[model samples]
Target chain A: MRTHRFAGYLFILPALLFFLAFLVYPLLHTVYLSLTEWAGFDLKKITFVGFDNFKLIPPDWIFWKAMRNTFYFVVGTTVFLNLFGLGLALFLNNSTRFTHVVRTLVFIPVLLSPVIVGVMWSRIFDPFGVLNQILEKLGLIQTPIFWLGAKNMALVSIIGATVWQWVGYDMVLYLTGLQQIPEELYEAAMIDGANRWQMFRRVTVPLLKGVATMVILLNFIGGVRIFDLVYVMTKGGPNHNTEVLATHLYEVAFWFNKMGYASVISVIILAISLVFAYLRSRLMSEEKA
Target chain B: MRKTWILLALLLLCATLMLPAAPKTTLRLWSWNNEGDYPAVFEQIIARFETANPNAEVEIQWVPYTEYNEKLKATIAAGDYPEIPEIHPIHPGSPMYSLYQAGELLSLNDALKTGFPKYFPSALADLTFEGNTYSIPLDVNNLTVFYNKNIFKKVGQKIPETVDDLISLGKALKAGGYMGIAHGAKDGWPAGDLYFQMLAYSDGSHTMLRKADFGKLTWNRPEFIEAALQILKMNANGVFPPGTAAVDYFTGAVQLFTQQKTAMFYPAGSWIVGGFDTGFPEGVEYGLFPFPRISKVQDSASTGGVATNWGVLKKAKNQDLVLAFYRIAADMKSAQILIDHSMIPPYAVNIQAKREILADMIKAQAIAQTRFVFTPELHSQVMSGVQGLFTGEVSAAQFVAALDRVEKTIKR
Candidate 1:
């Protein structure tokens, strides 16, 4: 029996070692780095400054701007994605030939890499691009709108591109949740004189709480860590108007070589993500209860 | 009889194994020059180096320009940098400066004592730190105005000789319903370059800027403010493209110029000469001219420095092979190869321009002045401030003051 347990441990050791090496070790190293001042090129040159990097965060206006932009993106993407995803899922709950085709079309953007998505959308948002051309043809405005160029519109444009890409993912998840609900629940609701809207509210929503929680958590985490799309699109430019936490971290770490300060920012991002994940677990447990 | 034959075969195998193996060395080189005719040029140089040293083999890794610095830094941090790593910018502001300061780069001083071709003094100064030469510049380039001849003819404007004339030309181009000048402010560096060009013209020298770079002087000087105001004035007059803040280097500025949407491309480097020869559309004729003088009392100097420099890693296993490679790369024959590919070599060579634009670029490089090397922090701050200026989010006073604030934080 002891030998059997030892054999099982031996079988799992490789994976456990990989997890510790790639994940846990890096996390601990990053925390240690956050407490030091280093140029990021030399490990021997690291100077322990004892939370000085954290102290710089509050006073740096760019950091505050990035935080605000990140918050806006997280809230914007999460709320809108859930709404559109649930709406589409409800409209195409019963799978058919047309619904299947539509579903594929909607999910197509999700299949594309974020870099491709960013490049495609940047062209679309160009001043003389298809979007402006259509708006001009329809006499929507006198001048072409600089979608990615304008300060107010840049973040909104990124959020829109992200939603267009990932809304289908949320839709597919909700579709699965919808299928998991028993047909008898809907039948009972209809037999009790409940209308379509009433049935949706009482039967569908209450039953999909678990999937909804998962979707929201995923979207929130994705939104918080958003990097590639923004990096490729705006590069946190036009006066750092669209700067987010991830892009700012990249700038400080790679461009500025302030790895310690960048590690501090990374720690904050990890903390935010962890708190949201904890809340998600609590909510999931409550739904089960 | 079979046992005797087996013993004889074993004796022959042992004799073959006793012979010494041939000595072979492989030298790895890393660079961001993968595009254009760079691959062909590098191939020729490597071919020559390998031929000169029969026992040596050369391996090259070409990284994309955007990701090269960060990737190189990561490799260095992991202690896996190649023997010959290309140090782009090759100035104090570059990430290689930190490596040099950390004693990670091999000093090329002793190597420079013999067999190396004469390089431009300014280019050599750029690669030298604290009296020690750290890298050798493969090419040097300076910025000049690239004008679309078709647009110039259509607008009936002549090449500007002074700031007033340039502004007038801009107005004429705008009035003709064309973009006056294409400035890629979105990328940050181009915008900062424009500002620095103006600052150089404003002060008649890069002295003030250099002083500020060394923390000996504040950035909020009269000349700095004047340069900022000039950018704003040009913007206010509709001299730039619509939504100038949104335009980037490649898709915006180069595209606009090649497509005949812009009358001129301002403050572009000599490195783009090769790109233009291939990328320009048929019948789209372009010409180069020096940046117009901003002050009548001072001569307008081109803002440029060396590019595509090479530094040897101190931990490089094959130092002699690395030195041999550098010797081949820094010679007149290598200069000729670079010239054939439309790259301006830092070494003195008999340059005969095949194209009119190349001739103009050569003329511009003759009068080019190297700018001060800014720290990375100051560089970023200046670039961000320039973006703000282009977007009209900050005035000249505000821009300089912000730079001063950032400058105060540097430890010097």
Candidate 2:
């Protein structure tokens, strides 16, 4: 018992150190920063104004608008990503040579960096860009409606770009789950006169619930933190219509140097992330049981 | 005999080692973007100084324009100040002014007396803070109107000379399915410039920027509300694209004009012919115009000076080389090179008409419009809030009110 305890401590020390340095310390420091104004620099002066920065955000309607945009992004990406990822996995799990190529192609978008994806797609979606040019040549619309310019569609446009870049990531997770599924179960279902749809609905889905649930939960936390894609595409613009919480925190901190106000935002974002993560993991576990 | 020979060999080796040490100490200099993104002419001058002072070796480090400010700030914060850098204060939200209040900016007034009297006077004004000269402005880039001749020709609207003509021209161009004025409001700076240009109309450039300061929440004031009204009218006139709130500057508005999708654009002098590819139709005649105010103001023609300025870090290691670089940068040879690269001269010049394609911009510049020096702090406030006003999302009242509320927060 003494040896086991000592070995456990030795095994965890490296991970604990990493967590302390990168995670716990930063989180606590940021919380402390929220109480005092420090623009990530300027050690000379720090003004303490507890909860005042939080109070200031509500009156600034743009903050609420940005929150709303983030909510839209989270819900939009999370729900669709799970469905599409699972669908692709189920279709490609047959393990034939042709299916290997299909699986490889399905997983390609996950490899691209979000910033590069944003820049490349901006050209594809521009007025005279390849997309509009192709569409015009095909005589689709009379004139080019700027993909990023239209206030009504800009958020959706960003979502489309983000989903294009991440659906592959979700699909790969589902593929791993599909592979773990036993061959005998499907064979048994076929013998019992279970059609492909019935097998998928009953055996395949129930067994893969663990993987699907994990993927969605992980994606939800990531979804809320989405910044680079939206920032590069729209910059929360057309009047904070596409602004998310992370970008808002950045503007308050870097642009305005309202370190205290920025910290309050950072704390709020962290809290939201924690709550979402906890709820997602709970729901996934309950479904499996 | 053996002892004498060893002594002679040692002395000869010592003499050879000291020969290469005759040159002056070497300094490393960095410049941001040959694309003329620099608000001052520092790099072009440094090259000339190296020619005159052969003993002093200066190495130039080329940094890309896009993230130059970010990278430069990181370098300075790490205490690695380059010998010759055109510094801008980061606190006013340009990322350069933040370093200024921290006392990282090196003062330069004592060095500029006889050596740089003909130095662009406004350049000195830009770098000045708390009655001390902190930077030297190589040139001042006042705002100008860039109009597309192709769109003007197609719409049959002759170029507008006066304020009313500009507005009416916008209305007619919209009817013709062409956007008349397309400066991006997606970013804060251009959006604030949009509103400031109106204030330039109401109170003139000098009073609007310098006197009626944005330090207070003058939201309830008539002037503040009227400033918003100008924005609403211009936006309502349908001169901007339908979804302008989403467009970022440079990548958005500049591209629209360059691509011939928009008829007119109002931007700082940094952009125009050289900002992008000038590959317009062979007959396309681009032109520049001064800011037109309400015909009734005391100074109806005054426009704001929206120039980028450079300064030296306070603890810079190589002051002599940097100052030497600044002096030779304003020489005529450097000035001619700047002109050839599609930039206007910061110093006084007799611009000959024969110098290629920039005659229109030069001609418009001669009208002698007064300039308002927009400090970085005020510029930051405008950049942070101006975009919201233009999208018709935040009313001018809300925009100014927000500015007033935050000004006290950041000013401290």
Candidate 3:
């Protein structure tokens, strides 16, 4: 037993080493950085300021705006991505050739580069772009609606594109979860005269809790770290309405040359993600009980 | 005896082959020239340089203009910058000066004095901050408007010489089923450039811009407020293209202007004039005009000078070879290449502008009373304020207040 324990430790050593080196070290360093002030680029320029960087964020209007926008993105992306993914998984859960083909088609968007996705969606949202052209042809609107150009519609448009990109990812996770349920349970539900909706609510949902927890946490974390699409699409613009935590941190670090302030923002993001993940895991554990 | 003779011959051949073939040096040059045939032009120039100097090789890393500065900053931050990285000219208020203050750049004054004697002093002064020159300019640039004369004629309008004239002309063009101006205000720089040009006509000049950069002048100053108000008025009066906030400078404005979808294109003259040869439609006559002078502002000036420049890294290895590359970069051949690309060469060389509009641009640059500030941060602040004004997110007063707040924060 002692030899087996040693072997198990040896087996985990590489991953533990990697985690410490890449993840833990960076996290600790970032925390250290949050306590100091440094213009990014040259470690020697760092000045220890001790929580002043954190203090500055609460009063910054842009930071508040970014937080509000980030909250919208996180909530919107998490709910919509999960809903659409589950819907897709349910509709295409069959093992038929047609369903497989449809699944492949749906997942094609996930394979596309994010930069390309951002640019493509930007063009689609253009005043003279295909979306406007189609909407006009359908008699939905008379004038061109600048989808990405208007502050009201820009975040919604980004949310829609993000859902479109990530739904397939969640759908695949859900499909696997669905397949894991026993056929006998559904048979017994039918024997008891529980209809499709009843069975889904009682059996399918409870059974899928673990997968749902994983997907929600993943989506929430992704929403917190969202940057590339925002970078490419509007650059958090049409008057900085689309600014999220990641893009704001980027602007502070690179554009504003406030690396220390950016580090503080990063810590906030980490803390938010951790609290979210912990709450979710606890809920999952309670569901299991 | 035969074996010994063979061995001696082989040794001689080995010694001859290993005699250090001119100490070939490879220098990495970073540039923000990731657009149509500009990279090709640089490649051609590098080829010429390599041919002239057999021992030197230059590898070009073409970063897109949008991400160039951020990437450069990251590289600097990580202490992994290239030897001959591109630096914007040394306006004291610019990010380049900030980099200099951080000791990131090597002083290039000696190299410039030794290798590029003909480089204009006024231009050199633009890149010098507090007794140290940070970069050697790649080219000089001036901001102006290029208008499609045919479209103007169709609308029965002459080139606008004043702000009111521009607005009126824009109205006329819109009525004629064309865009008034192909402006990519979405990119921020276009709008910033417009404000800077307008600022030059006001009490604000390069000095005022520099003052704003150093937190000496507030954005709520009368001159700045006047400039901001004028810009807001221009946007309100429809002086830009439809969906102006959605348009990008390169793919939108340049493309639309080249395709004759817009009547006017305002951007950097030196950079935009090159499109006339390559992308512009055949027989589409265009004319150049200086940025229209505002009616209320007394001072008159234009925005131009050595804009894009390059500096050696403080940790740059092979300083002599890098200087050699600078010599090649600033030589007459390189100047000729720049002239070919519609850029004003730093050295004194007579360029016969092929287009009449380009000729006007060159003449205007030569005779301008003052130049715009090369400070990126000032321009960025102005851009955000102007954008806020355009979007009705902030009133002119609020915009100025926000700018003042930024000045305070950055100063801290």
Candidate 4:
């Protein structure tokens, strides 16, 4: 028994070392960096400023704007992704030949890199692009709309692109969850004189609680750390209208060379993600109970 | 037999040890100038350098222009930068300035004192920071209106010489169902350059601009606000292509101009001459003209400076080899290579213009003014403000106010 336990420890030692080296060490270093004033060069030259970086965060309007934008993306993506994912899953539950083709077609966007998605969507939303031409043919408006250029529409456009790419992923996850729920549950509900809506509400919703929690949590976290699409499309531009926490952090660290302040922003993002994770775990536990 | 074999091995070892080993050194250079004729130009220069120093080799790393600055910064932060890094757009607020401030660049004052090619005074001034020259200016360029002669002829429009004339021409072009100017405001720098040109024309000299940059003057001054308003006015008049705010420089403006989707001209730098020569469609005859003066009373000022230059890292191992390469690069031979490729070498060599447009560009560069300096934070803010103006997100006063707010936050 002792030998077997030692072998198991030895088997996992490499992964443990990798986890410590890559994850734990960087997290700790980032925390240390948040307290210092460093230009991200010359590790020896990092000056300990002790909460000064964090203090600067409150008065910085751009940082607050980025936070607000991130919040909007997270909430917006979560709601839409869940709504669409569950709807598509329920619709495609029958698994016909046509439904299979539709599933594959919808999943195509999920397989594309975010950078490619951003570029493709940018063209589609271009003022003189196909969308505008179609609208013009319909005589919907006199002039072209600046989808990515307009301050109000830029973030919304980014959100739309992100949801398009990830909705298929959510649908697939929900389908797996939906398949596991036995038909007997629906039959039992129907035998009790429950209508179609009541059957769906009482049986489907109750059974898929675990998968819904996972899908929503995954989306919330993904939205919080969103960077590449916003970067490639508008670059958080048109006057920082689409600026999010990740892109702002990138600009601060790389462009402005304010590594320490960027680290602070990173810590804030981590904190938000942790709080969400904790809430998710609580929800899961409560559901289990 | 064993004794004979051992004696032969001993003799072979002795002969190998007696022969002197060849000395070799490798010089690494990083640059964002990887497009068009730049690679061939660099190759020719490196071949000359290698021929002159038989034992020395040059390795060039070409980074894409968009990601070059960020990559350079990150590599330097990681303490892994190349020995000779090219610092482009060598102005007061450029990456060269930041690198110099961090004491990462090698001061070339002593090296430049002797046996160096003579550069234009203005070009040298742009590369110098606080009485110390950090980089050798490779080339200088200025913004000019690149117009398709065919489109201008079709529209029966003459070149505009003043701001008002340009506005009227833009309106006329728009009325004819053509895009007046195909500006790519997405990259931010192009729009910023246009605004700076407006400022230069408004102020005549860069005095107020310099003062505002150094925090000695407020950015919300009438001249600055006027420049902002001018850009907004151009946008409002349909002077720019639709979706101009979202369009990027290369894929948007350059493509539109080359494809004849826009009429009249594009406000861009002279560096694009070489690219346009190759990229422009057949029968797309183009011409160069200076940026129109804001007022007839004011002299037309071209906004540009040294577009390409190189600096040595302080921690470079092969400083002697790097200096040797620089000496070769600064020679008239290298200048001829760049000139042949349509680049304006900083050297004062007599330019025998191969193309009529190149001659016009050289003339425009003669009266070129250096762009206004800004701190990195302030520069980013100004770029955002310019984009906002084009996108109708902010008005001229609002843009100026935003600049003032950012300027106030910078500590000296």
Candidate 5:
């Protein structure tokens, strides 16, 4: 038994070393930086100002604006992404040639680079772009609308593009969950006079909870720390209408040269993610019990 | 005697081996895509410099323009910056100022005095802080009105010379179903120049912004408010295109201008002529002029000055080699090279005009030199205020007030 345990430790040593070097050290360093005021260029210039950077966050209107935008995206991306994912999975859950083709087509956007998706969507949202031209040709609108110009519509446009890109990822997970559900449960419910809707409500929802939880948590984390699509698409512009936490952190760190404040924002992001993950694990354990 | 000669040869060889080797200095240079063919031109200059100084060598790193600033800041934070890096004159909050404050930039006073002429006085003044010069002036770029001659001919109107004429012309072009100005406010930096131009044209002073930086004046003054109003007026008069807020510089404004979809464009530099030549749309006869003056302002001026300056690291080991390179870069020969490559050099040099528009552009810059210095930071507050003006989130009064608020936050 002692020999076996020693061999297991030996086998895991390389991976453990990499994890400590890349993840653990950097995380601890970032936390240390959050307490000090540094310009991010020279080490000698760093001043230890405990909690001063975090104190600046509450009064900073830009931080609140970014927080609000992040919250909206998190809520918007989670609810809409899950609904669309489940809907698409239900529609194309069968083993047919048509379903296979549709699934491949749906996954194509996920295969595209995020930056490319941002640029493509930005062009598509242009006033003279293809979408507007089609809309105009169909006589649905007399004039082209500014998809990314308006304040209310910019976030909506970003959400639409994000959903289009990530919904397929969710669909694949839900589809697997659906396949694992035993057909006997459906037949048993049918014999007990339960209709399709009742059977789905009673059986499908409960059985798919694990997959649903995974999808929501993954997407929720992605939405909370979102940066790339907003960056390549809007760059927190049109008067910062689309500023999120990650973009704001970038601006603070690089543009403003305030590394300490950026670390504070990073800590906030990490804490939010940790709390969500912890709650998820607790919920899963309770469900098992 | 033959044995004696052999022993002498061996002694000489031993002496040669005893002498220390000459240390070959390696200087790392970081630059971004400032213009077309310019990077190649820079590489050639480096090769020539290397040939002249056989004991030294240079390594150039090319970074994309979009990510250059971020990457540079991170690299510097990690204490791994190259010996020299390209610095911008109008970086928001002034990255040059931050680097200088952190003692990361080398003072180039001795270098300029030794070799380069006093060609970029305004730029030098801008980069100086507390009696220390931080960077070497490299090139000058002016913001000008690039108008489509065919668009003007279609409307049967000459290019506007004053703000009122611009507005009237814009209205006429709108009536004719064309955008008056192809300005993109999506990036927020381009539109701020309009406000500065207005202030400089009206006030006849380019120091208002610098004054604000020193807390000598607030932004809600009547003149500044008038400048903010001028932008709002332009927006209200249908001068800018629909969805102007969504269009960025590369993908939207430049595309529309080149496609002849808009009549006028405010390209940030004269090098845009190169862009026009490469992607020549048929029947597109473009012209350049300084931004027009407001009709009511008696003293009118145009905003013009250096766009970017190169700086050396303070603790860089290759100071002599870097200073030698600066001397070469600032010489008239390098200026000629710049003019040949379709870039406006910081120093004046005799060059045959390749095109009539290039000559016109050079003449326009000379005229603008006397008018006003480039005061980009003066309008940084207004840059942020553009979306509010477009979205009706802030009134003109509120906009000016917001600028005042922003002024208070500037770290000088």
Candidate 6:
């Protein structure tokens, strides 16, 4: 038993070191930096302006706008991505050659670089873009609805793109979990005259609870942290409407030369991440129990 | 496990392959050129410089516009950098106030004492730290309001002579399909500069700046709050388009102007001249205006400083080459070509300073009598708070209070 524990520690050591160096170290340092006014680049001289940075938080509406956009994106994507993923997972869990090909194709978006996805989608949302051109030809409406033009609609477009990229990832995770379920149990249930919904609810869903918990948590984390696609596509613009935490943090630290304030926001984000992670793991435990 | 290790190794390989190894030859340039398409200009400039001087080559990179100071801080921490970046668009001036205290950038007073004064005295003088010029200007840009001549003609709104004329005339123009003026409130800088125009004309050039310089926190001064209120008043009058606050300078200007949605777009001359047709949209009948002075304002004759300038990075490998490049680029001949192409050329000795296309633009510059109106530093500081005020998220008093707070914080 001791030997097995030792082997486990050895196996985990590299990952633990990586997490400490990249994640933990940065988090701790950022928390420290949050209390000081360092012009982000110069480390030697950081004026300790404790609490002043935090006080500026209330007036910084752009910061709140970003956080709001992040939440909306997270919630919107989390719900839709799970649904689409589950639908895809169940459709392909008993895959034939055709379904396997379809699954692989659906996963192609995940394979594509996020920056490329953003750029391509931005082109699609252009006023005379392919999607609009096609929709117009189909007699969908008289005039094109500006996808990224209006402030509210811009957030919707980002949500759409994010869900599209992540649905496959969620689907693959659920599919893996689905593959582990015993076929005999489902067959037995059917033989006992359980209907499709009944088998799904009583057996499949209850069994997949652990996977569902993880997927939702992962989706939540991803939704909050999303930056690149939003940055590239909208840049939180048409009047700073779509701005989120990561992008705003980048602006504050780098653009505005307010490293202290940026660090405070970073620490807040870290706290949020940790809370979500804890809740996720707890939910996972409850589901398993 | 085998597949995962192989995949991890492959990923590492790809990451390593992506970062460019340090070059065999060394040249360092610090520029504000961030857009991918526009980096081509620097490439051309670098290629020309390299051809002229064969011993060294160049590497071009971008600094995030917002976190530029942070990147500069990191470079400072790194102990050695090739050269400092040039022409930081929004530098608050008082260079190295903190950095100088730490001994970062060099004082370039010697360069200023030379004939460099003759090239761009105003640009050189403004960036002077403690009565000495510390940076050489590569170029100068000024804010020029480009009205769609077609829109102006349709609206029959001749150039507004006073703020009230604008308010009244713009309303009548709003009855036409075109927006009276397209600049909006949500955008931080445009609306802020619009106030700068008002303040410059009203002898408020140093209203906020004095507060900032003296650390007095006087943003509640009647004129300062009233300046933003004037803009909001115009916005409320529907002088700008419906949903005006939502439009960015780029979208509100180019997007609307191209669609004939509005009558005027206020952007700097560098953007106004040829930039629109190539990148944004094709031609709309365009003409330039100096920032309009209100009818009875005391300093209506002064121009606001929206100058684009160049500076040398301390670690720049080809500092002499960059200096030489500026000398050539700022020459009268080059300035003429720019003016002939419809630019409001800022070089003092420029060849085409007398050109007809640039006549009104030049006249406006000549009329910018107070001259201090242009730096935009105070305007830059108070813009966001003002934008918040414009958006109704804060009251006018709250907006002034925000500026008052900034004045307390940043005033050296």
Across all models, the iRMS values in order are: 1.8, 3.9, 2.6, 2.3, 2.7, 5.6
Give lDDT per model, in order: 0.83, 0.68, 0.78, 0.83, 0.77, 0.65
What TM-score, over all chains together, does every model reach? 0.93, 0.85, 0.92, 0.93, 0.91, 0.77
Residue B228, candidate 5: C-alpha displacement in angstroms: 1.3
Instruction: Give the winner by DockQ: 5 or 6.
Output: 5
Fraction of reference contacts reproduced per prediction?
0.47, 0.30, 0.33, 0.49, 0.60, 0.16
Q: Report the error of model 3 at residue B211, Å.
A: 1.1
DockQ for every model comes to: 0.50, 0.38, 0.45, 0.54, 0.54, 0.12
Candidate 2: tens digits of C-alpha lDDT, residues B45-67: 65568778877777767775535
Please give the lDDT score for candidate 5.
0.77
Lowest-sum lDDT 10-residue window in model 5 chain A = A54-63
Model 6 lDDT, full chain set: 0.65
* Candidate 2 chain B: 10-residue stretch with minimal lDDT: B368-377
Native-to-model Cα distance after best TM-score fit, residue B312 in candidate 5, in Å = 1.3
lDDT of 1 at A220: 93
Q: Which clashing pairs does model 5 show? A: none
lDDT of 3 by residue, A1-289 (tens): 9999999999999999999999999999999999997766667878999978877876677788889999999999999999999999989988999999999988999999889999999878876678988999999999878677676777998999999898899999999999999989999999999999999999999899889998998899889889999889878876677888888888777666677889999999999989888988888788778
lDDT accuracy of residue B113 in candidate 2: 75
By lDDT: ranked, best first: 1, 4, 3, 5, 2, 6
Docking class of 3: acceptable
Docking class of 1: medium
| TM-score, candidate number 4 | 0.93
User: Candidate 5: interface RMSD in Å?
Assistant: 2.7
Worst 10 residues of 3 chain B by lDDT: B367-376
lDDT of 3 by residue, B37-122 (tens): 46766787789878887888889987876676678877877767677788776555455555776887888767776868477776
